[model samples]
Structure formats: C-alpha cells, structure tokens
Target chain A: MDDAPAYSPTPRTRATRNRDRVRYDAATVHAILDEGRLCHLGFVADGAPVVLPTLYARVGGVLYLHGSTGAAAMRAARDGGLEVCATVTLTDGLVLARSGMHHSVNYRSVVVRGTARRVSDEAEQRSALDAIVDAVVPGRSADCRPADAKELAQTAVLRLELREVSAKVRTGGVNEEPEDLDLPHWAGVVPVTETIGAPEPDAAMAPGTPLPGYLRTFTGASD
Target chain B: MDDAPAYSPTPRTRATRNRDRVRYDAATVHAILDEGRLCHLGFVADGAPVVLPTLYARVGGVLYLHGSTGAAAMRAARDGGLEVCATVTLTDGLVLARSGMHHSVNYRSVVVRGTARRVSDEAEQRSALDAIVDAVVPGRSADCRPADAKELAQTAVLRLELREVSAKVRTGGVNEEPEDLDLPHWAGVVPVTETIGAPEPDAAMAPGTPLPGYLRTFTGASD
Candidate 1:
C-alpha cells in the first residue's frame, strides 16, 4: 500500500514536517479514528469558516457524522458539496516541567479533508447509523432499541470519504533543558487516564433492570 | 462587538457555513479556548489533509502553539501562509442508552480558522512560553525554571489570531424517544470528569520536598 496513489490534494501542510510525529500509514490513521468518539469538523460557510463538534463513526474508508436535520451546517453540506476538514484527538498526559517553557501535553489525533455528502439512500443511512451505534458500544445495535423510520428521518447523516488523512502523536517525559536540570523543582509526566466508573442507573429505571455486562466490561477504551 | 466587521476570504469553500453550531459570540469562543489545554489542527498538505494534536495556550486574543523548529505543519504555515482550521474539545460525560441509537457523549468544543504566523520576536516567544506554563498551573511560571535564550531558540511558536472563531457545546441527559421510556434497560449519563490526583514525588527528590499546596487544592477547573 506504500506505493498506492495518494489522493490528489493530499499535500502535507508545511508544519507537517515533524517527521518523527507524522504517521502516513493507513492503519495508524484508522486506529486513531476508531478509538475516538467525537470529531471536530471544519468547513467553509458563507464566506467565513465554521467548526462543529459532533459524534462520528468510521466504516470501511469513510466517516459518518450526524446532526439535527434542521442544523445549518448539515443543510450547507447537503445542498452544496463542501470541502470539509474534520479532526479527532485523544490527550494522554500532562507534561509538567521544572521550567515554565517546557510544560506540555501528550496526545494523538487524526485529521481528514474531503467533500461531504448527505447519506440520502435509506439503506446506506441505516448502515451508517449502525456503524455509529457500534462505534460507541460494540454489539450495541443488537441489544438496544433500533431506530425506527421516524427517528431516522429527524437526523441528517453526512459521509466524508477518508481519502486524505493523517495522524500525529506525542508521548513521554518532559524535555528539560540542560541548564535547568539542577533546579530543585520537580519535573515529570502527570499521566492523564480516562476511566469508566460504576454506572449510575437512571431514576426512572425499572427496579429489576440489571446493568449490561458490556457496560461493566469496559476498561476505559480510548473511544 | 456583534457588529464588528466579519472577516472574509477569497474563493470561499462550501464548508464555511455561518451556523449556530459553528458560530459563537466572542465570550463563548474565548471560554472554550481558555478551558482547553490542547488543540487538533487541520490543514491540507499536498492534496491530502493532515491533523496534528499539540499543546496550546491562549493569551488575550491569540493562541500559541509550539513544536520543534523542524515540524512540517509549522514550516508549511510559516513559509507559505497556509490556511488552517483548529479545534479544542472537552468531553464531560458518557451517555449510555437502552438502545444502540441513544449511545452518545456530551462535550464542549471550539473551532477556529485563520492563518498562523511564526513568533519571531524573542520577547514574544518567551511570553508565549510563559502563557503555556501558566495555562497548566496557575502560579507555575513564577515558581518554575524560566527558559534560557539558547533553549528558546530551538523551539518555534506559531500564533493564530482569534478572528474567526466559534464554539459549540452539548450538555444534558439522553434525549430518549417517548416510546422508549418504558424500555427495561437503564438510561442516564455517566458523568466523566478529569481531576488532579495526589502528586507522586520524584524518586530523586529530597525526602522533604513538600507537595505544592496548589497541586493539592485542585477544584476540577474546566480544562
């Protein structure tokens, strides 16, 4: 796949030169996207720029994003093919340094650019929704209430083909300058971890409803 | 402020819609920026798109992002004045539903569009670094080691002026369909939070290095 022709506009941004941080292989890009639950989408609206935060799921080589049918962003994308830029990120830790200059955070993220189209076909829409359901909770669509025709009608799903994508990541200890190595102040990584705590049943839940095993089994997966 | 002349661009793309979800008042935009410690930046390279996840700090109306002087994205922006879209997000909870369709997450995010410029002045570079330090720990800049001139020379800081910015936020419980109310499965938000844990003293530190009171007094401040 290394020799596969890249998408036409797949030029790396000038700042992308961090050879050590950029990941060009498809698997790395997909891994970052699969593990992320939310994405920030940027597109040109009117003569200005707009960014929306929304839930997303990946299937094959495309990503699906949904919003209210009446949302302006959705309307714009559906009405006119828009060049969309979307990004997903997962922060891993806070790098606390002995010097103020070196304080930083470690993270992984993926960005994609493509023209998004509304998933108009009913069959495709349903499939997209299924991908979203499974993306949030594996095997969820099989266990829970499925979306009926009415619910599906109220939501708009946009599909962005992930033809142009890249992932960047940073990890490890703070980079302390040699001159400041002798400072008495401490320097190290304050690992940031996401944990799934015990589930809280809704007040309206039935008395006998037991917690789903899937919920209990989650060990704070990145997504 | 509402009447301030909006920024305009040449050859606007379809993705730049002026919608509520992608548009925000100045205060809301600033709040989102202030509460985030990292950002995912997106831009087209070659013909493909790339996203880089990195630490950032906001000062007044400008955001400061830094990387090794050799990064591609930074070099692209610094040399060619590339257009970039960036996003910052904070996830607040996990919304688990009785049905697969309802699984979702609640979050707050901000997206901005602008051309990034390299911070060439030495004083501004130092100040930007200080802002980054203070952004993570309120009183850290004064207490920690300051960046020396040589160390500062190797880092590159890019400033993105907050001219065209928007913030979108979703907070609340699941919006279950009326018909699914009686489902036997549990439904509610599992609040997710990030907090500072007890600081572990460095192994090489002197035995009596007192834990900073500030580290112990964390109030789960947003960010």
Candidate 2:
C-alpha cells in the first residue's frame, strides 16, 4: 500500500513530501473535504494566476463546483483545460503565547490538485447539483426546488476527481520557548469557535409557515 | 487617471474590459486586504502548483505572511525566487435559490500577484509582527510580551508589495431565471454569519482577574 499507483503526469507539488504533515489516506482526506462547504480554487488564467473562493461539494471521489455562466473564472475553468488547485480551511482557535514569536492558530486544511472537466451528462449534472445542495444543508435537495432542464443547461458544473488530495492540521496549546515561559505574559489558547445564531425568519413569510426541522437541528458550527 | 502608469507587463489575469472590477486604486485594494485575516497563497513549486492556507496582515503597501520556519512552501518562497499569488475572501452569506443551478454564495475577495521577498531587516520584522498582532486583536501587541532576540531569529517573515491587486465580489439575492421565480422551491439568503462567543479564560489565569476590554470588544467574527 505504500507504493501506490501514480495518478497524473504533472509531478505532485514538492510540499507533498512532508509526509508527517500530509495525510494521503482516503478516510482522512474525505473527512476534511466532507466537512468543508467552501473551497478556494487557484488556477492560472491567461498568463497570471488567480484564486477565487467558490462553493464546492464532494460526492464519492469527485468534487463538484459550479458558478454563474458569466463568471470569467468559471468560464476559464471550463474552456482552458487548466490544472486547478483547491484548498479548504477551518480555523478552530487563536493560540496566544507568552512571546510574540510563538503565537499561532489552530486550523485544519485540505489541498487537492487535478484537471477539471465540465460535467457533460444531464443525469450526472443533476446528481452533482443535488450533492451540492445537500452539502450545505443536509436533506435540503428534497425540501427545496430542484433545477429545471433549461436552468441546468445554462449553468456549468465542473468535476475534479479527488485523486491527489492531502490534509494538514495544527492544533493544541501555545508552544513557547523554555526561556520565555517564566515571563509575566499570559500564554494559552483563546479558543476561536463558530456557531449558528437564532434564525432570522424572513419579514415577508406567510403566517402559517414554520421553519424546517433541519434548520432547528443546526445547534453549532457545521464545519 | 484612466491611463495609469504601466508596468513592464500588464496584469494578464485581469479581465481586460472589466475595469471597474479590476481595481488599480491602492485604497480599494488595501481595504479588501485589511478586512480579511486569512489568505490563500498560491505558487508553482517544483513543476505542479500548490496553495497553502496561512494567516496574513497588510500594512501600508506591503503584506506580511509567516509560517513554520521548516515548512517547505515557505522555504520555496524564501529561496526559489518564485512569484507568489495570494488571495483573501470573506463569505457574507449563502444564497439559496429556487433552482439548484442558481444557488450561490455572497462573498468579497481580493487577489494579488507579485514576487515575494524574505524580510530580513530587524525593525521591519518587528513592525510586521506588530501588524499581524494588531490585525487579529487591536492593541494586543502593546499588551503582550514582545519577541526576544533568540525567538525573533527563528521565525521567517515574507513581504509582498500590494502593487497588483484586484477584488471581485458577488452579493444579494440569487439571480434566478425569469420563469423559475414562481417555482414552489424556497428561494432566499440563508444569511451565513460568523460571530465571536464569550472568551474562555485560561485555566491557569489568576483568580478573579477581569477579562481585558479588547477581548470583550469582539462583537463580530474574526475570520
């Protein structure tokens, strides 16, 4: 299992060799990808590189990303046959140190690189669209309106198989130098957390409408 | 002002005709940079490209980023003389639509491309460290212990001048097709938000020591 099959011709990024920090196992990679709702995608467009933050969802081994038909970055991904690099990060806390040099943040991040292709099949696009919907709000695809034929035809969905993926994470208390530990400064994790607040019902909602159970189920941060 | 001074090579990733979105104005560029705390730094390392999530802070016309002194990505940036592309994004909300195809998120993001140089000057490094501290927690730099000589020498800081930067944003309701407006699907902004919760005092804090005002002043999400 250590000697896995090589996936692509483009050599893996040199940073991939940090084997201690890089997790190549499928379960670890999927866990990070599944929990993240948004990804920052980087690709070279024209001559200079551009990084665009976009919504994405993982289904099986592929990641489905879609955007407006008019978005130039989306258009470039569809037409240029570009190699796309993507990352998703979740920051858990702020590590405050006795010394400024030791300050850091606790975070989990995954980076994947692959060639993206537009999802061509109608049935596949529909499934990918549903995966995207469910990615943000579990079981939302059935409760919400599904895409009609014409709308699906105009929007573009690109599929990048999660072949070359890795997750890197850093967590825990401040790592201060031994000499500075005796200083009078405070040193600990000032935990940074994300949580959902009470839902603000739309002003125009009809009198009889009630919020969905799924909405009620969101007690803490999703990612 | 329309015909600004041209550099050797025009920004190729910039959309030629979308001048309004492609901001050359330094004020507009810095505003985007200042508003966000994390950035996605992209570069071609070895042959394939890599993107890493890291914390960054902007000051004057320069951006400073730091990572583990042993991180290969930072080493490459410090030694390989490669151009680096970095971007920061703030997700305002999730835009759910009646049609799956039209579902999207509202966000503000900035992208910058330039060659990065290792910061070596002592005064500048200290100032850069201060900018990062102030970026996360205003006035905390003054309150905390400053880095000692040995600690300062172990850290790596890189500077990227904000000479070429652009911001692209999408906000408000989903742009649904005309015919799908009447569809029975729910359509509105889910209104994603990030906010700071009550700070958890360190377990080792002196009994009854009051929390600092700057920590109490965090009413919004830092990320």
Candidate 3:
C-alpha cells in the first residue's frame, strides 16, 4: 500500500458530531474501503433517496462500482453521469457501557460523495472490472477466464474519484459515565470478526482442478 | 418472534431486475434487519445524496435510528420528517466463478425506503432507546442504568415504519456459463461468517464487576 495521498474534507464531507473520530487520511479510507466486499450506494431517484448494496473497489484515488446494465441504479447513473454517495462500512465490535445512552458500535466507514461517471472506454472498463474482482479475492481474477467483448458490453461500471471523502472510525474502550461505572453491568466490547470458511467447489468442477494458491490462505483481509 | 405484517411492493419498491431473488414476505425482511446492528441511512442533503452508517433497532414494523441531536442526518429528519432509505446488508460469501464477469458476493440486504420522523413522545422514545441497546446485546438494556431525562434530551431517534420495504437475497451457487465449465479454474464459494470474540473488559472496569449472564454465549446474532 503505497502511501495514498490524503484528502482534505469538503464542506459537505465535514462530520458534525464526534469530530475526534473522523479521519481524512487516505490510508484509513482505503484500508476500510478495501476490506469490505460490498458498499451501500446511495443515489437520488425520482426526487427520493435510494440506497442499494453493491460490490465496489478502490484503485489508488478512484472507486469503481459494479452492477448490471439493466439494474435501476445503473440506468439512473447513465447518460451524463449520476451524483452518488458510495459508503463502505466494516463493523468491528459492540460497545457495551454502564449507561444505556452510551452504547454504540465500533466501526470503520468511508463515504465517497461525488458524481459517478459511467465508464465507456473499453480498456478502462476492463481494468476496473479486474480491480472489482481482485479486490474481493486478491489473485483470483487472473485464474478466472477473462471477460469477453460480449460480457464487457453487458456490465455497467461507474468510476468515482475519491476527493470529497472522509472515514469515521470508532475504536476504543467504553465511555462509561463516572456515576454509572459502579453499576452491575458489563462495560466492555464484544469483538466482531469476518472469517472465511473452507472453499466448497462447484459440483460441475473437474475433480482434477487444483485449488488455487490464493484460496488456500485467504483470510479475507487485504494484505 | 411473531410474524410481522407483510408489505405490498409499491412502484418504487418493486425491483426491476432479478425479480426472482426478491421476496415480499415479512419474515425475510425482519430476519435480515434484526440480524444487522448498523444500517446505512441515506438522505438527500442540499439536493445531493448522503449515506451514513448508524446504529438502529427494529421494534416490530418500525425501525428506530440512534444518533446525537446535533448530527447532520438527525437534524435533517427533525421537522415533518426526512425522506430516507435505510439499508442493512449482511455478506454471506465470496462467489468464485469461471468467468471474471460472473464473480459476485452472496448477500442478504433489506432496503426500507420511507420518511423518517423524529420521535417526540417520551414513552415511545424511551422504549425505542431500550430496544436499540438490547438489540446489540439481548437483555443488555435492563441491566444498565436507564436513560434519564437529560440524557434522553441529548439523544435523537428517528422512527421509520417498515411499509415500503423489500429484501434481496442471493444464496444459491455460482451462475457459471455452460461454455466456461470446461475452464480449468475452481468455481465455488468461500463462505464468510461474522463471529464474536471474547469480551474485553474496559481498563477502568471494577475488579469485582462480574461478567453479565447475557454475554456468556453471545454469538452476536439476534436472539
């Protein structure tokens, strides 16, 4: 991970509450973005807010989103490009405090707000596609059959530059109040983790096909 | 868990693509919602879309969002109500396919598109607060000190009924092409699971404070 350039917060991206937890560094933003497999994409449709969970990838300063060309969010993002907010969140732990009001979740989330431009260039789209696939499985994209021309034409990829981005991270001890510290309640954190299970091959797979090296040690964390 | 009432799909809620994967039943929607501790809350701000991850609770059909009174999203939902789309996604696996374009993540997500009204009733808001706390750790709210009037005044809760809702699920095997089955690549799924680790006591926790009964086998799943 080359030290990705940092981002200055824009007016809209500036967080209001818990200002101390907000981070503007690209290291924090990209680490959080790269770990998650899905992003909740937010866009306005028919003058109403719409949020859909979809796959995404970050290559340097750009974030790529994947969807079928016929999907509603893809169609809405066509033509001159659509203004969207793509946010990826990774849940860390559940914060249990002595006071009910102090309860919260320890998480790392990044929000990229900008116009998502539809990729029309064939080469750019292919690269973005590779990133999307490899982002989930570091080297599995190379092992798979590449997308053909027909397949490329059917997929819809949106490119959004990570400029107005801010990552909000909460990682620490319980913020129990002084008076409630002595209460008979659990004041701690229940750590949450994402683990990858053993690979289950498709029934139609050739029995001789060896499991790729990438799958053997795939801990699901970006290395 | 009682069977919540089902909701008929409206024009906007009806998905255009992958209609086969869509379910209108209440069980599917509630299960996906309750299992998730955070929801990506989306709202239109200055005619631009914004999505933020926040803690939430499901008390029957209504979803309550927890935030500080000074939060931007909470302030936007204060008056009559704020048009919002709350989405909760639980990733299941990393689907490995023969073709790169066919790669996808198996996930269960619920999208509740409606207006979020600021909860003003004292009794209702208090109940919602308990539900939010207990939702993270079952029986947690009862053991902790209840929120006093001053604490309640500082918190913001938005109530969004689960009327315009839909759950999209992708649980089956890989959708590999018939032609690509001959490819010498592994086609299968790497199961992804969310597991909870042992509780870490706070540095300031009293030595005599026993771990609560509810945390003995906390699987982090909604019980």
Candidate 4:
C-alpha cells in the first residue's frame, strides 16, 4: 500500500503546549476522526466567536457536514467560504492525581482548520450524506431509505478538505508529584466508557421488524 | 428558594436554525453544563480560530478552568481578557431517519460567550481548583491531597461568568418523511450511554488501600 502524506500542522492547528502529545501521522488522525460521532465546529460569526455541536463524516481526506439549506451557519459558509475550526474529543478516563493541582483527564482530540465550501455535485452529495449515516452506525446507509430528489434539494452539504489537521492524545496512568505519591489518598483511573444500550423501536413500526445486526452490536467510537 | 437570573442569548448564542430547541432558563443550562465533564473552548489567536478540548468546572454562576500558568492560551486569556466561546455537548442517541437527508443525532449542548479573566483572589482560586477536582468525581477534592503553595503558584485559574449562554436540545424518535414512512426500512434510535467500568488501581498503589466509596459507586455525568 502507498504511504499517505504526513499531516503537517499549520500554525492554527499546532499544539502550543504538551508538544510531545501531538501526532502527525495521517492514519492516527483519520482513526480518531472516524471514531468520533460529533464535532464542535467553531467559526467567527458577526465578529464574535461561536461554537456549535454538529454531526460530521470523514470521507477519505474530506470532511462533510449536512444541514438544512436555510440553516444560518451552513448558509454563512456556503455564500462566502468561512474559516472553520472543528474539534472532536473523546474522554477516556478521569486521572485522579494525588493533588488537586495534578488532576487531569485522559483524552484524545483532533483539530482541523479549514475553509468550508458548498458541495453542489448531486452524486457526491448523495454519497456524502450516506457516509454520514454509516458513520453513525456501520451498514445504516444501505439498510435505510435513500434520499430522493426533493429531499436532496432541501439539504445543503459542506465539504472541508483535511489539509491543516492535528491530533493530540494523552493516555496511560496519572502523573503526580513524587512527594505526594506517598500521601494517604487513592490515586487511580476511573474509566469512562460509552456503551450501547437496547435500541428502542419506533412506535409506528409495522409488525416485527427484526433488530438489524448492526444495532444489536453497536459500540460507539469511544471504545 | 431564590431564583436565578435567566440566561439571555445574544446574537452569538442564539440558535438561529432551530429556535424552538433554544432554552433560556438558568436551571436547564446549568444542569447541562454540570453534567458535562469536558468542554470545547473556542478562542481566536493571531487572527485565526482555535478550539481546544479541556476540563472545566461550574461553581454557582462562575465557570473555572485550571491549567499551567505558563500555557499559551491561559496566559493570553489572563494577560488581557480574551473573548471565549465554550461549548459542552452530550449526545443521547443517533436518530436514524428513513431518508439520509433527515438523519440527525439527539444531543444537548450549551454555548457560552464571555471574556475570560484571571482568577486573582487566592481564596477563590483554591475553591475553584477544588471545584474542578470534584467536578470530575463528586467529593474528590476533599478526598485528595490539597494543593501546596508552590503547586498553587504554578497553576493558573481563569473564570468566565455565565452571562450570555443558551442551550439547544433535540430528543425523541426519528423524524422521517411522510412519503418515506411506507418504505421498508428500520428507523429508530440507538441509545448511547456513558457508563463507568471497574476502576483500575495504580500499579504502585500500597496494598490494603481500600477503594473509596465514591469510586465504588461512581456514575459519571452521563447516565
């Protein structure tokens, strides 16, 4: 297999502190993005900062976000390309250090800085939308009804190239001061895990629609 | 019981797309913020947007963030009050609509717009540090060793009052198209739950150190 280009972080995406935690490999960045279900999208709106939690999907080297055509943020990005910073974070566990100052959380996060533009192509739009559905649950796009022409017309899709991206991760045990290590306080990690619960069927389901294989074994990206 | 002031939304915090999902009550916003363990902090640096995932705690009406005093972002915010947009999101489930266009995720999210200033008062700073610790695990600050003067001097705490904030929430079943209702496809929600697993003790833990009651019965913010 051909090697992918290294994700060189620009000034905007570079990790200013904890420089050692930064990861530049494309595979590592892609894996974290694929495992994430949501992205906190940040943009400058009306000369002030604004951050919104939204659904996103990564297809190859491009990230796609879908929303209504009339949505304010999407329209703002589509009319004139908007500079956007999107971040995805997965908290693994609470790092219980010996001292209050040393307490931290183990987490993996990725930040991407890019300009978002409208995806006007019909075929690409349909596939991008499918990629988002399948990102939520694998095999969901094929199992669900596809979007029709009218449905497609009402939705707006924005594409962001994964050029300026960086991933930062903190893992393993807690780091505490050596003097405080002997203190009479418990120091360990309490794992925070995401588990799939029993899927709830729609009340209007027609008869016995078997629970799809994917839903039965669904474990979200956090694990 | 004394009532809290309602969090009025400025143009920045308003939910422009889904106005119906916007919430103004302080209680609702505080609940969402307290239940969230992490937040995506958005700030502009050198005329570019940046978003970082970090731990935060909300005590009463003030939100505090603790980190190294020399960290670039915290220093920037401390030297001259920096405009910040902090967001916390809790994803409840994935809404699978019949059409790809309608696929959405059930989530509760809050956006706060304010200027972050250095927490100078020593007393308040100590309490803020404790709040940050207990925020991760209830009653953790009291259980852990308190920060020494040197530790306190190295740590920088920043406070942002919860003045301009708004919350947006989407719940319930999938919203499928009327025409697509007859399509033979599974449409439901796969609930996503954050659960606590068995706590792994530190390798260097002294034998016979009993796991605290709080750790034994730990339930993270998300149920």
TM-score of chain A of each: 0.87, 0.86, 0.93, 0.92
For candidate 1 chain A, the 10 contiguous residues with the lowest summed lDDT are: A7-16
Interface RMSD (C-alpha) of each candidate?
3.7, 3.2, 1.3, 1.6
Candidate 2: give the clashing pairs.
Answer: none
lDDT of 2 by residue, B99-198 (tens): 6666666677777788777787999989889889777766677767888787688777789876676776666666776776666554566665555544
DockQ of each: 0.31, 0.37, 0.80, 0.71
> How high is the CA lDDT of each candidate model?
0.69, 0.68, 0.85, 0.81
- Please state every model's RMSD to the true fold in angstroms: 5.9, 5.1, 2.8, 3.2
**Error at B197, model 1, angstroms:** 5.1
Better of 2 and 3 by TM-score: 3
Candidate 4 docking class: medium
Question: For model 4 chain B, where is the 10-residue window of minimal lDDT?
Answer: B214-223
Which parts of model 3 are misplaced by more than 4 Å? A1-4, A69-72, A219-223, B1-5, B68-72, B219-223
Q: Rate residue A8 of model 4 by lDDT.
A: 79
User: In candidate 1, what are the lDDT values of residues B41-123, reduced to their tens digit?
Assistant: 65654444445555678887788876542356567767866566677888888787766566777777776778888888989
Query: What's the number of clashes in each of the models?
Result: 31, 0, 0, 0
Give the backbone clash total of model 3. 0
TM-score for predicted model 4 compared with the true structure: 0.93
Regions more than 4 Å wrong, model 1: A1-10, A13-16, A67-81, A219-223, B1-32, B42-51, B60-86, B97-103, B111-124, B150-167, B195-213, B216-223
Residue pairs with colliding backbones in model 3 are: none
